[model samples]
Target chain A: MATFDSENAAHLHRELHSHLPSDPALRVKTLESLAIERGLVAPQTVDAWVEAYSEHIGPKRGAQVVARAWLDADFHARLLEDAAEAIKDLGFQGSATGHLKAVANTDRQHNMVVCTLCSCYPFSILGMSPSWYKSAEYRARAVREPRQVLSEFGVALADDVAVRVWDSTAELRYLVVPQRPAGTQGWSEEALAAIVTRNSMIGTQRDLPLEAS
Target chain B: MDAIHDLGGMQGFGPIPIATGDKDFAALADWEKRMWGLARSGVAQGVTIDWFRHGLERMVPSDYLSFAYFNKWCANYLMLMLDHGSITLEDVKRGHLLAKEAEAAPKSIDDVLASNAQANISFEGACDTPPAFAAGDAVRTLRIPPPGAHTRLPRYARGVEGRILAHHGAHAVPERGAEGKKDYQALYTVAFSAADLWGPEADPRDDVTLDLWEAYLVPA
Candidate 1:
């Protein structure tokens, strides 16, 4: 179809979000169209486009690391104790855990994350942040009432488990490192990665599965 | 903690900002010649062998540095240009490729942002204010588990109510803000004595103020 640059690209990108669909898949299509319109798909722009795509789709090579850690205890403890080191074990690359402690989601208290100030996420593990993750709305509200924010995501927590909202401060940014879900008793990395949506890695998603049409 | 640049809040209170927009490339060619805190010809502390320390402090009230991220996005785009040999930092300074810098010399970083390509966002039914709180009021953080969100309420501070300190401006809603066109919604700061948000183990005199919105407080 139409591509960006020359003149009309900015107009297309400016309009892409205006009517974004609720369906994540549909949203991805919308972004792709915008990228094309913006001339982001030119052969010269392939790297940038690939980078954008990876940011959205290629994330969770980090989650796969987390999943493997869930399968192994010594690794799990190491991950909880020192996320940077634990992550290095998986040969993943990122910036958030270099100085700060990376907290893992547990059975006791389900965890969520956000860069209320900005969109500082673990792109190494989770890939590109979902469009919502970068928006100012989530950034501002995620910190104010984390529970309510999670509720909007359809994640309702029971009263017992305490919530600890962590900020990805300048000293050290944070990553949720969500717990692996059940049902896939002996799934491999590929299978798990398929189900391990980017939202799950960011802590905005929950265990609920999408119903089949 | 600190503002992105040194000299604190004021951008051009004392020093007249030199135009680093175009002439910087030639100046940077002699960057190694300039003694910017380095003892002699060596690299400054806190920098890698190749990277020099600019000694800038990037900070704001909110958690992540949006400006830094924005700068990062710009820098990456520039790097992409560099990789393709599309333009040099000198070209960037010369106002050759940049649509924004072609104007008068940018006085400061803010000036640069003003000059460059701008992207504006529109919010639908966006609530800029969540009423029911004021500065110097007492409040507490609700202890609700996050199903799937990256939140800021520390576990140690759960159910811990803090007093409302200076109400920072309303932040954009992040869920929508994440869409990237500047969705900084409304937000407020709730102050908690480090002792209260933490515990008796914390310093009673030390206060811990958090930038929060009305949704977190249940009229504590």
Candidate 2:
């Protein structure tokens, strides 16, 4: 029986598919790096592979629906009601999270999301994850010290606004649809897209004012 | 519209610590550094592919995201002034520049990766998978614990019986707990009536379904 052919090995091979290398050298570096990541290989090859893979993937796009939602109230509602389908219409599948649900953040309340079991997230729409967001520290502390966690992200809730934390259940990967900012009143789609940061939509960061055109 | 982390500021909780040393700044930075170090180290050692890259680590989080995150701190006062037309971008710019410099470092690519969960999976759970269990059938949740799992299945669900409310289809295993390996995994929703999962005290109307792995169940 081949040790690298177990169920886990298959999974490893699947994760391996996500890798991209610009050249032959980077390809070797990436495989070597992953072996060390799983504690399979030695330490000397980690950085080169990381550098290669890191260069392959781009910033998480977040949900394009956040921008769509900002413009379309009905779609926004649908995103809140059924995040997966609403997003699928936009061609965003929860690749990271096989299934998904959306949570919204409002002025009266702020929402923070975490995967208690492990960093369950909706990557189809949100994009590649933040390292800290998936870290054990973020997961363990987010629930126990939520206020502190929000504070770290600089989300200061008022006395009236509530702060809610969602501990990811086993089946669902969740993301945040932040409230549309007031200032983008007449901004065009492209303009609105400029101000929509990935973290803001994820509810980890807040919205910034659009520069006056 | 609530985030999974929106549970703070509830009435039952005590007064939260404010500005507590950058609000666990040391810990957060340390956590990222560790992940960064380990990930980089893993590559340095022998492991090579990371399914994704985090954003901040990839590109500088534009001035916009910087304000989005940092504004939640002590800057609220200044922001309110600017919002009410009390201050100009010029006024804030000077202070902002200093703050940016102070806060800035070699931008990381951590946030460039998936903000949501991205598990590596092979088998595609066809949308139209045939059902093994029906809504009315009484079923039990399988309790096979895979190695390296920090699962949420209560101990009671291990050998207990519940009805199969729905067949959720084949789902890719959650890659994180499985150390980033996910494959064609069968998923089912085991509906434990409030009373069934807990006891008679559980409310009859407030039933919940446990999204379970096929490995976690057998017929009751």
Q: In candidate 2, residue B101 scores what lDDT? A: 16
CA lDDT, candidate 1, residue A61: 66
The true-versus-predicted C-alpha distance at residue A126 of model 1, in Å, is: 2.0
Question: What tens-digit string does per-residue lDDT give for candidate 1 at A1-213?
Answer: 111111221222222223323343333233223223333332223323232222332455655765676677888788767665677675554433343245676666655665543455654455444545555456555544556567777787665644555544222345566667667668766665566555665666657362211
TM-score of chain A of each: 0.67, 0.70
Reference contacts preserved by each model? 0.00, 0.06
After superposing candidate 2 on the true structure, give the runs of residues whose Cα lies further than 4 Å from its correct spot. Answer: A1-30, A33-60, A169-171, A211-213, B1-150, B154-220
Tell me, by lDDT, which candidate is best.
2
Local distance difference test scores for all models = 0.42, 0.45
Instruction: Please give the lDDT score at residue A101 for candidate 1.
Output: 44
| Per-residue alpha-carbon lDDT of candidate 2 for residues A81-147, written as tens digits (9 for 90 to 100) | 7676676565455354445667787777666676543355654555445655654356545544555
Please, what are the lDDT tens digits per residue for candidate 2 over residues B1-220?
1112222112243332223322221233322323333333322221111112111112122321232222111122222222233333443333222122121122233432332123333334543445566677777764545543333443434566877755656765543323335454566656554455456644343334456666666777
Candidate 2: DockQ?
A: 0.06
Among these predicted structures, which one has the highest DockQ? Answer: 2
Scored against the true structure, residue B204 in model 2 reaches a CA lDDT of 42
What's the C-alpha lDDT at position B192 in model 1? 57
Error of 2 at B192 (Å): 16
